[model samples]
Target chain A: MSKALLYDATLCIDCKQCEAACADQNKLPYDDNIAKEERQSEHKFTAVLSKNDKYMRRLCMNCQEPACVSVCPVAALRKTSEGPVIYEANRCMGCRYCMAACPFGVPKYEWSSLNPKVRKCTMCPDRVLAGRQTACAENCPTGATKFGDRDELINEARKRIQDNPANYIHHIYGVEEVGGTSVLLLSGVPFEEFGYRTDFPRDPLPLRTYQVLSKIPDFIPLGFVTLGGIWWITHRREAVAAAEGRQAHQAGKELK
Target chain B: MKIKFTFWKAVFLLIVAAGAYGTFVRFFRGLGASTNLSDQFPWGIWIGFDVLCGVMLAAGGFTLTAAVHILNIQRLKPIVRPTILTAFLGYVLVSVALLFDLGRPYNIWHPLIMRNPHSVMFEVAYCVMLYTTVLALEFSPIVLERFNLQKPLKVVKAVLIPLVLLGVILSTLHQSSLGTLYLIMPTKLHPFWYTPLLPVFFFLSAIAVGLAMTIFESSMSSKHFGRELELPILQELGRVLLVVLTVYAILRFEDLLHRGVFHQLLVAGYERNLFLLEIVLALVLPLTLLAIPKIRQSAGGLYLAAVSVVLGFITNRLNVSITGMETAAGLHYVPKWTEIAITGAIIAVGFALFALAVNYLPIFPEHREAAGPEAPVAAKAAVLSHAGD
Candidate 1:
């Protein structure tokens, strides 16, 4: 029942209807110049980035094991069981560690606010929960952004590549990148040429952090015991030295 | 009522005025308008210099406490009080700097009530909070003594050993955790500063810089406060600095080699040049200078070497936080004049507080009475050793 979006770049005509729809749905100011936004921002969660006469959507990849979710100190950003990654403004302390941790650099901060929050594309989790497509997919004029069950959409993407081997690239962009994102991207050109981060490892980024954090318990005990032992031995020597000196002084008094 | 118009005081007042103005703009206009920070470059010198370098410099508290209280290094006992004060003030400054840097400055306390064990920043926040409290407790005896609170002094004395041990433990965790903050940033962080053993590198360098900072503080205090320099102890500290620096340099190069990025050093590039400068100036130059017996013994030579180490370490932190991530950030980030002004003001305030504490409290450990003009330095050392016991 988990939903996903299949974004076929070949069908996208840079119309930016999705961007307009997203802005309207999210209550952002309408912008006709959506293509001018080369990157996503706090106000512009979704943008159409153009390169060499082709367009690609720049939004949250919505990974299964999101790095932003993992690194958020207050659980302000969460990946729901339903599918999309969502952010809670009230819960955020504005640490912005999520902004740094995300591989795709999806999370944008409201830096100018007296009270700022991390902003990103939520993939319309509320709409999906109501059994409807995301605003972007619902409004795509060319049927480029098709929303459905993740497994089915992924299979459909593979079938398109298989049927049109000469027209499409062999690889599905998000099938295994960063432990598989919920959003699948298909392109005529290679994913990298369209500005996808193809260099990310297959494993989730948090796995590396876990590898280091798992060793903390070992450090605490080892550091305490080692430091404690040094403290005891050093102070014990001083205490004993002082005691022996006291006894020697008593012996001198008795001799006198 | 006219104020004295000394040059330094004028400079201090100007910094405070500029800083207050910057802080006003920062709070009113917000981080976007005030700072050069963006989505691309979320972190800047405030995090690097104020938080990272400030925390490292304050490491003298735990290192000196462990040496004097745990290791029974009697010669270091005299300077323990002053070093703890410096550390306490340093941590306080870091906390304040964080307040300015955080986007929602009011929610800085969310980490206290909200728990997120998975995040390294969670660990850092908890450690910094706990260690600052420990430092305050460790420093309380001095405050109590000044107030003639004999009963409270006795109470604090009972738990002094445990406090020192806890301080060491807390300091070790957070100092390393600061490095762990960047572990998730493997891609963004340049390979030169990025390593699996970054935490270890941070811990080791903190120890080295801790010792150097102690010497740096002691030398300055000796000149201004007219206290004895404790040349023998400072010389011994120099030797330790030399050894720590050597070990740190060896480990760093070994890490680079293991990662198969040794060729990164050979590349004629900006990152490579910065990496070389950091290693050579901070590690190599000071290491070489401190190894010489003459340089270790002479006050001026020791001061120069310690300053080199301090500057070198600061450069290393800046490079890690700023220069390392430059390419990935895409846009160049030159910190706003407001950012520099605020940082300068924080340092100025820290120094002013330290001076106030020194003038009022007994930071120099009854030095003039024990280390009299007639007493030879060796004899004075013996007196202080007995006093420590």
Candidate 2:
């Protein structure tokens, strides 16, 4: 039973209760270090993005094989025994390769710190272990972000979509995007129109990354063999020239 | 015409002071305080210039060695050792830049010992570490020879062939791996720059830029060092540059066409403008200039083409890692004054390191060496006797 969360932006009223509750639950600071000029956007795991008469709940989608986890050079970020993709800032070297690798572009760096750690929604792993609900699910007044087993959540969302065709878009965001995400989304508008990435292929994220890495095997040998042939030719010339010079020197010395 | 570089020393000190202050501000304030980086622009000039351009410039070691030791083109020998030294310095600079980028630099070793085989970055970390070692091994002969240690130098020389090939293989893998590092961020990396062929493009451009930088670095070294310019050697290099650029241009256009981003080239904006500039200056101009047999033979003209290609490589890196990447929502990064300082600091360190190596070590070739220079008979006498015994 894979754990998942369903975030329906349609139900989000932009109340920011989820954000407030997350901060309160996690004991996160307002980050005074981020100066007024530096604070371009609000900081938190779950953010409500509003533009063009639409609102979006931005949080970790927890893809089947999370890119952040796969791309982390250190095992600082890992998938938990349960299902959540997590990070141990203590272990992170902060190369930010994970930030570059996330297709959804979800990881946020703590650039305001002398020692910054990447920040993202961890799906309230701590609360789940303690048999409690995540802050976002518990505090959502409109029942927008619900937490439960992934299959149940998908089925429920599907039932809702089937019940109201006009009220909902036919496609479920994250069902197969980037080989399926644990976090699901229900939307009234198409996911792409709202800046959601729906065009990803079915391959695991790292395999797609290997689009370039896989060909290197061929070139390594080719590059070397080409160099080797050149080496042999040049060395052969050097050997022949050296022998000729020695023979000429011997003849001249004999005459002397 | 040897300009004694007390002038450079003065510049180095000033840069060091400014860089130190910048680091202080960054350490106290944060990454945002130092760089024009944001969630949307997480990788800025720091990565674009420091890692991408630096690595490409370092390609001289691989390309030149492939010519000399591997292909046995002994004419290319004068360029080889110096280029390797330059590349070693470039990689060291890249490592330094990565340290600055790390959120928790202290914890960097955790990944090294942790051994996460499943991760791409895990492979990258190991590769960087191993390649750095290979580079050091490849460079140790200069230090030994400078000390006039024939025994150690003999031992090092014996391993040279194997080591050079290893370097080529490692460089090829990592040079391309650097591109694969971006594979996980397909949606984040712009479609125009982000193609399935990114690794191939990176490998091809690296080969060209490697040759270009070698040509560029060699000409500069000759102009400054009072070493007789190896005009004939570089004439052949100019030919290589033309071929590389021709291929890169064709492949680039093919990439755009394959991805259907050729239309993106006509989008009537800054991205398009930058793309046009990249085509004209970095690829087309260099290709056109070097294509002419007479122009390619001229020392000055060939050098300029190399620089243009280097500049072109830098622009491409910036476009892929920063300018074109649109990650992070409602957040745009501007390099803090500290970011500039830190970047300057890394460069300053690179310059300082080069100064130290060139002065103390035998990075530059002696004039007689490239005129078919060989090891002094006296120095080889004892080792030759030992071999006979």
Candidate 3:
């Protein structure tokens, strides 16, 4: 029920404008190694992925039944009504089982800090609930990271691929990758080249966790002894009782 | 029951403190602070050593119990209670170890309250809880009978079979599940450790480990208690272990061949060396030692073989969970000091409990004929029958 944003890296411009806006808005320090070292980097709803010939924007795809939410063990991570994966750090025990379980590796742990929060792109659920467009979409200079309903986004992605065959790959990056992420991408090169897993599974990771867990009967044969030991004890008690009864019989015969 | 503080008691208190400290740190901070667990190797020593392999090593309690009780071999009675206590302690350690790995220890109740039928973790949680309770109930009569609570003991005795059967069923589900937990990570697991038949592999290894543990624990306990051991039955148990280990070896390679990952085993690396070590220690060494009566009859030889087999099984599990796991992206892992301390403390508690149980409760058999090497089946059965009650 949440909406996801898709970014086509070919359209990003690495002007550092989005990063500046995000740092200012999120109260994060400017681009400096000290802030990074502090392990307190505030995650932007959208990030302009740096160090490549073409700029890539990074953000959460707002997966349906998100793996982080599924493997929360507790409902620390939740999917809001409007379709955004949100976090409640206070209730979180900081157990990063969610980080491991996510196939996309979307959740980042604040490892250096005594109190760490899992950092990821939240879909701006607070704004969406208030009937506002996301800050990332409004601020995007090239319209690379789009915000819209998933249905409309996919249609838009398809139309772009059809309109400019030379500029776009026929496939949308997140549309079918891992069971159709809310985000959709239209790009010139293959998804694999862009550092996105194009062949990821649509099936939620929890099911796979379950499939292996179900076959645990491997220890049952060993448990047979629990019952057998009980049986042995019972027999031993009976033998003791018999021995006592024989002693009483001998005493009675001696009295006769 | 109050007396001078014993050596085992001191050790137990240390374990409790270490375990408590680990939990406190986990609650205050997070898993990264307390463990070497990472995105690459989410399941570190806790899952590999504690849950996967520890349970199998603990399998001796049930194997010895079944041999003595169900088979009417009375000779096995002396070791039964001690073995059960060990098993109970083993399960407790495994359950506690799980808390270290869980992200939200407080929310552990959510799984019980909110049933996720599809979650492998759900089954593991349910079985661990159920089996732990079953283990406690099964062990209660020992405490009760000692206290002269005839009525409670009677009630327990009446329901023993069904409770044990329930335990067996639950054990089957969780043990195989430990192996099955890795099945989905086909890409993550090294070829030597992976296959659709992972469940069967886990099952076989557990049986062998259980038998080997009985051999080792029994022999080791005898050193402390000075009770005469029924060495012949243990030799027979060793033979059973040989069969299971042999089958397991064949299947290990068979699974690799089936999956076309046979070459993966020979790829010169740590994983390959670890896998080879597991085979040589757990299977080939024990198998060769136990095959010839000359070597098998010696308590020293057989006991060494059993210890090696147990070590081998631990290596096998490590390979399955740690050595073989392909991370999302990263290098190899090493557990944090807190994690290692916690694991060590857990085994110490197991030994402490075993020591206490053997000392106080009737753990060892009273007296038995010394085997002059060979023992016919009838003589063996007779020796077993006269061992305890």
lDDT winner among the candidates?
Answer: 1
TM-score of chain A considered alone, across all candidate predictions: 0.88, 0.76, 0.75
Identify the CAPRI category of the predicted complex in candidate 1.
Answer: medium
- Per lDDT, what order, best first? 1, 2, 3
Expressed as tens digits, the lDDT of each residue in A163-242 for candidate 3 is: 88888777887766556676566666666654567656666555665555543455455555655566667778888999
> Residues B1-389, candidate 3, lDDT per residue (tens digit)?
22445444455566668867876776676777887765445567877887787787767665655566455566666666767877888898887777666555555566666554554556667887888898898888777855668998999999876776776667767777677666555334666776778777887787788878788777855654455776886777777877887888888777777788766666687877888898899888988997888888888888988889888888888888777764334477888877877777666656655555544444444422222223222222222221111
In the range B1-389, model 1's lDDT, one tens digit per residue, is: 23445556666678888999999999999998889989998888899889999999999999999888888898878888889999999999999999999888788898888777888888889899999999999999888877779998999899988888889988988898888888888778898898879889889989988999999988877766667788888888888888888899889878888899887777798888888888877988898888888887898888889988987888888888888988877767789999998998888888767766775666777642243233222322222221111
Question: What DockQ would you assign to candidate 2?
Answer: 0.53
i-RMSD values for every candidate model? 1.2, 2.7, 4.9
Top candidate on TM-score is: 1
Instruction: Please give me the DockQ of candidate 3 compared with the native complex.
Output: 0.22
Q: Name the lDDT value of residue A104 in candidate 1.
A: 86
- For model 2, residues B231-287, the per-residue Cα lDDT tens digits are 888888888778877887888888788788887766786567767777777888898
Q: Could you arrange the candidates by TM-score from highest to lowest? A: 1, 2, 3
How accurate locally is residue B14 in candidate 2, as Cα lDDT from 0 to 100? Answer: 68
Tens-place lDDT per residue, model 2, A28-101, is 75432422121123266666666676667777877888877877777888877555788887788877877777
Cα deviation of B73 in candidate 3 (Å)? 5.9
Q: Positional deviation of A189 in candidate 3, in angstroms?
A: 5.0
Clashes of each: 0, 16, 21
